[model samples]
Target: MNETNDMAVARAARLDTATLSDALDRLGIVGQCHKIKGRDPEFRMAGRAFTLLCGPASTPPGTVGDFIDDVPPGAVIVIDNGGREDATIWGDILTEIAHRRGIAGTVIDGINRDVHLCRTLGYPVFSKDHWMRTGKDRVQVERTECVVNIGGARVAPGDLMRGDPDGVVVIPRAHEEAVLAAAEEIHAAEEHIREACRGGMRLDEARRQFKYHQLQTRQ
Candidate 1:
């Protein structure tokens, strides 16, 4: 809705992707960014999506990342490169610019290079993988601020994305409130179960008391 609302949602979705994934499953909503992984295992990110679609290079070979100038701060740059592993659509220069601009992070269906800068700056970049080959002549920007598929998840403008050591997950703008609520409930139940166990309750008893097994079951 607004920047304040987005930040609040982002903060609530801070739970690791695993917990959010369980919440999505419980709600029967598909938001997991399957096969996409963070470049650095410890890297973390959360922000609204600013999608970019990429296709095979055209006759004139369109630009690789001039769109950087247009991305708003606190928005994640989501690039859909058709999962091409041979060429990378992101690199150091873009990472530098994104970090300077306070952009949240970058997620790609393809690959990225110049990761040293990302690692150095703590600018999280998640993708299928990374490679040295540039996409300058192999791919081009097809569009921006439109829906794009990352990994297997469809991301639209303003959709919330959260990433961690586990992986990335997209919360459809329309489902953000529901997903966040579910995840919070699940997290609290888990904490209760742990506390019960620590207080000498049997693991099975704790789980049953907390409904641990059903936390992720489809409702």
Candidate 2:
């Protein structure tokens, strides 16, 4: 990652999903990945998105993860399987390769399998859920390095993706600086409020002093 990208990732890692969501809301941006969640609440990831769109298999079916070989290090694999839950598009083999290659993480609008490997390897996998069923012969890759729908959010190649215990959010490449600025501001304000409360200031007074209620309101 370049210095700018590294800085963005670091800034995002310090802010939770809620703060980022509020930042997006303040900017009138739609970024929350609805219904998509982190498999392990303790795990967090931030990186540019490497998107893949999937659909029902063709007559002979198609590959699910051949694209892994091309994914750059530090890029989060964002897979859009049309929210299908019957099968999984990610598993142990992919997890191992991704980990070894220094890939940031994986997020799916559908599901994943062999979650044990993910947890054991300390790799982060965010998705709708997980199942043991395989996606092979059931799901096929439609396109790669393209815009893909994740939950209700549109994720494009190189878009910033951040996830934590709360969930995932995608920041458009064009809006990274603005979004990060907003989120950092919100985080600072929240920290001030917290410190005030800890120092014996009444919650209501502290919140009122900082205009807390308006922090997340559309601006």
Tens-place lDDT digits, model 1, residues 1-219: 586667655665568788999999999988999899999998899888999999999887898899999999988999999999999999999999999999989999999999898999999999999889999988999899999998788899988899999999998988888888899899999999999999999999999989999999999
- Model 2 regions lying over 4 Å from their true place: none
lDDT string, candidate 2, 1-219, tens digits:
689988888888888899999999999888999999988878799999999999999999989989999999999999999999999999999999999999999999999999888998889999999999999999999999999999999999989999999999999988889999998888888899999999999999999998899999998
- Candidate 2 worst ten-residue window by lDDT: 6-15
Candidate 1 segments exceeding 4 Å error: 1-4
Candidate 1's TM-score reads: 0.97
Question: Each model's TM-score?
Answer: 0.97, 0.98
